[model samples]
Target: MSLLEVKNLKKYFATQKAVDDISLSIDKGNIFGLLGPNGAGKTTLIRMITGIFYPDSGEIFFDGKKFDPVNDVGLIGYMPEERGLYKKMKIGEQTLYLAQLKGMSRKDATAKVKDWFVRFGMESWWNKKVEDLSKGMSQKLQFVTTVLHNPKLIILDEPFSGLDPVNSNLIKDEIFRLAANGSTIIFSTHRMEQVEEICNRIALVNKGQKILDGTIKQVKQDFKENLYSIGADSLPDTTGNEPYEVIGKKEQNFIVRIKPNDKPNDVLQYLLQQGVSISSFNEILPSLNDIFIKLVEGTETARQFQNIKN
Candidate 1:
């Protein structure tokens, strides 16, 4: 049920390859995370998908047909990292105008605006001008406009850029609501925790190439390094003698980077045999950030460390 598919996508600017042979798909109703640090070619790929730029060598498919820039363009709602809105216009007036531009009828647009205004508790401010709104408030106004058209596909870049925790959570909830109601979202953000929370599928890109892409769980498992985190009341004194190598030790816990060939339970038994009381024993899986750096540095580092026998 992929709503969007990209194949061998390539984009070159001058002498640089911004997107090289990238291939990925976005399933229906998925919140796919497009992640990369600055200058990683994430924006290049997004621009092509949104029709802002043409791919040098590739094809895009939307809804089982070859993508037609004009028709399928209306089916997508894109919120660029840089917010786009008329600063001098009233919130209610501007929101309705944008919705209408997206093909929403006047009456339906107004009704939906009212519903969102009440939900966001911004009914009182709707009559006010966008220029008078704070940065966070302006973001909400722009966000409302982006989703007002009820497009089947939504691409949000840095959607939570200017909001406080409360507002960030509010927008996050609405994003989940949209997906639940049959919208597919391509969410791009630098916040690993946010991706972990909301994104089902993810693609990590670096240096104009797709370094990795998969389900969140699958990606994490792929970057696995058999490590253990243990909290103990009395840690064994292995100053000179123990099979386990402690990577680090904190207040009440020690982070052990285990040999991949060693079983986790075997490490636990060795600790217990040394009369150490284990309070908590947990595996150390790679975080999205960790995985990103590993991939960009070259996936070979992960391979070398994946099967070490101690």
Candidate 2:
């Protein structure tokens, strides 16, 4: 059974539809990416899932049961994009307070907070006030508080914000560790590389609607343009109109879009027959960033066209 499920969920504020008829299911131990452009329905959808807002229509299921905010509060951890730390509170005290509010006993919260501080190398910062920490340090403290209770499900929105590369890697490794230990995660971010690295599946929403949903591999394959990148000392000019189109070029490098049904081997044979020594050859698979720009821009263009027609 899926760890979380939403069925035709919808939410509206006045005349604006924040989330419209979105449905998604996340299985246990998987990192599911909730992705979209700015002002898209991603935030609204997340709020509904986390019980910060009730859907105007449809239903959500948690652990195979209908979600009841009061009863299911302890089962999930949510870290919003905005920092919620109390500036005047000491790090250790604040973490303990947050954990206890999440239903953990004070004793258990203190012990877990101490262990987390040691793990994150923040033992010395225990007595330091939140206002004294740098942006990155505060981000780390927020992360510790979010996970202190060891909730079965975790939702992180823009978790890497304000984190330096080293600290980002630290959190990335911890995310994997949590997932490996049977925790389900809902990751929301604008960083495509992070999603590509950690998410097994993703759902992209835009303008209050779901535009894309699938495993990362499936989505990429579906968006594949059959482009190939070749690196060599030099590339021969396709003066005779070779079977492939040269889409990009740089000094000693070329990206070609092979025709439908054309094999890479055939392209290689042609290059060899032309006396071209290949230094490198590989398919130019689209990155998540590439796909995101394409889909979002395409949707916007279509919307503009529709408005013109109307």
Candidate 3:
């Protein structure tokens, strides 16, 4: 079942359509990726969902009921791209304060904070102020505070930013654990590779609109160019009657595209007839980054501000 749903959501600014009639649903226990280029209205959409902003029109449903930003906001844990921590505050106190803000009892919040600090090897840093920690360390602390309350919906914007590979994996594992334990996550990041790796389903927003939405596998299939890579000892020159056309070559692999009326099997059969020995045959699906570029390219390099009349 969908844990969160947005229908015909619109949030407009005086000079721009920050979020224009967008709609999507995120299922329970899902790690959903919300992606877009800079100035694509993703932040605006997220703000509305998180209750920092109200929609100009349309509806939001949380856990099967109409959204009440005042009450439901407590169920969401949002870590914005820009870090928000008090530089002068002690780590332990800050974390506990944030948890309580999310409606956790003081005693419960302290217990959870201590557990997370120990788990993240941050036990020694409790009394240290935020400014004293390194960027990566601060990031880990921010993450701990965000999830300290065990929110039902955790929205992490660039959660892995500023962390080393080891630390990145640490947080990644926790994200997976959270979803496995029934927490739904909305992961927003510009790193397409990370999205491809971590998200099972994604929605791509561009210029205040949702241009793409589907599972990773389904989206790849939808945008596939039907290209294939064949690795062999040798490849014969393409004959006019061949079932496929060799489009390119890379390191002993010939990249080919099957003819309109032909299948991969037809290509293999034709290659065998020409005395070719195939070592490997694999279809080449476009990467999410490639698809992202293909769809958003040729549009404005930056979103242009416009005059909104009304």
Candidate 4:
């Protein structure tokens, strides 16, 4: 069953559609990537999903029931891109306060805070004010509080923003650990490589509309370019008059985007037939970045083509 669902979600300003007919779903224990360029309605969608704002036209459901902004609030743990914490308050004190605000009892919050702080080697920070800690350290404290209540769903917007590489990996590892422990995560990020590595499914939104949505692998395959790169030692004068049109050539061999009738086996046989030594053979698969740009640009090309056809 889906842990979260949005249907025809729309949020608009007087003269702008902040989020326009956006819709997608996420299953339990999976990381869903919300991707788009800045000012592309990503933040607006996140706000609606986090219950920070109401949608003008749409429905949000959680666990198969209509989603209520209030009732479902506690069930979600949201860490905004902009970190917020009281800089003058003691670190431990602030964490405990926030945990309790999330509905955990004071006693439970304190105990949880202690366990987490010690595990994170932050036991000595119990009395240090937030202003005394480094940016990464401050983020750690805030992150601990965000998940201390063990929310069923965790929504993170650029969760690694201010951390160093080591600290960032620590947080990434924890994200995967949380999923392994059955926590569903909604990961919103602009880092395409990270999305490729961590996300099981992604929904790419542009200009407040969903342009693509599906499993990462399936989406990549759907956008495959049907091109192959062949690296070889040497070949015949393979040029203009050659049966295959060499579209591009790199250091080792030629890069060819073959016609539909050009079979891989036939290409290989022809290369060998020409006495060209084959060292490496590989097909080019579209990267998430490639797919993203293609989809976004393809929308415009498709519209232009349709206009011409009409």
- Most accurate candidate by lDDT: 3
Clashes of 2: 0
Worst 10 residues of 3 by lDDT: 233-242
| TM-score: model 2 vs. ground truth | 0.92
Among all windows of 10 consecutive residues in model 4, the one with the lowest summed lDDT is: 301-310
Best by TM-score: 3
Segments of candidate 4 deviating more than 4 angstroms: 239-244, 297-310
Model 1, CA-based lDDT: 0.85
Give per-residue CA lDDT, model 4, range 98-188, as digits (tens): 8877888999988999998887889999999989988888888777887888888898988887899898888888889988998899998
Per-model lDDT:
0.85, 0.89, 0.94, 0.84
Candidate 3 vs 4: which has more lDDT: 3
TM-score of each: 0.90, 0.92, 0.99, 0.90
Root-mean-square deviation per candidate: 6.7, 3.4, 0.7, 4.8
Clashing pairs in 3: none
Ranking of candidates on lDDT, top first:
3, 2, 1, 4
Q: Write the per-residue lDDT of candidate 3 for residues 1-310, one digit (tens) a residue.
A: 9999999999889999999999999999999999999999998998999999989998999999999999988899999987779999998999999999999999999999999999999999999999999999999999999898999999999999899999999999999999999999999999999999999999999999999999999999999988999999777875689888889899989998988899999989988889999999999999999999999998898999999876
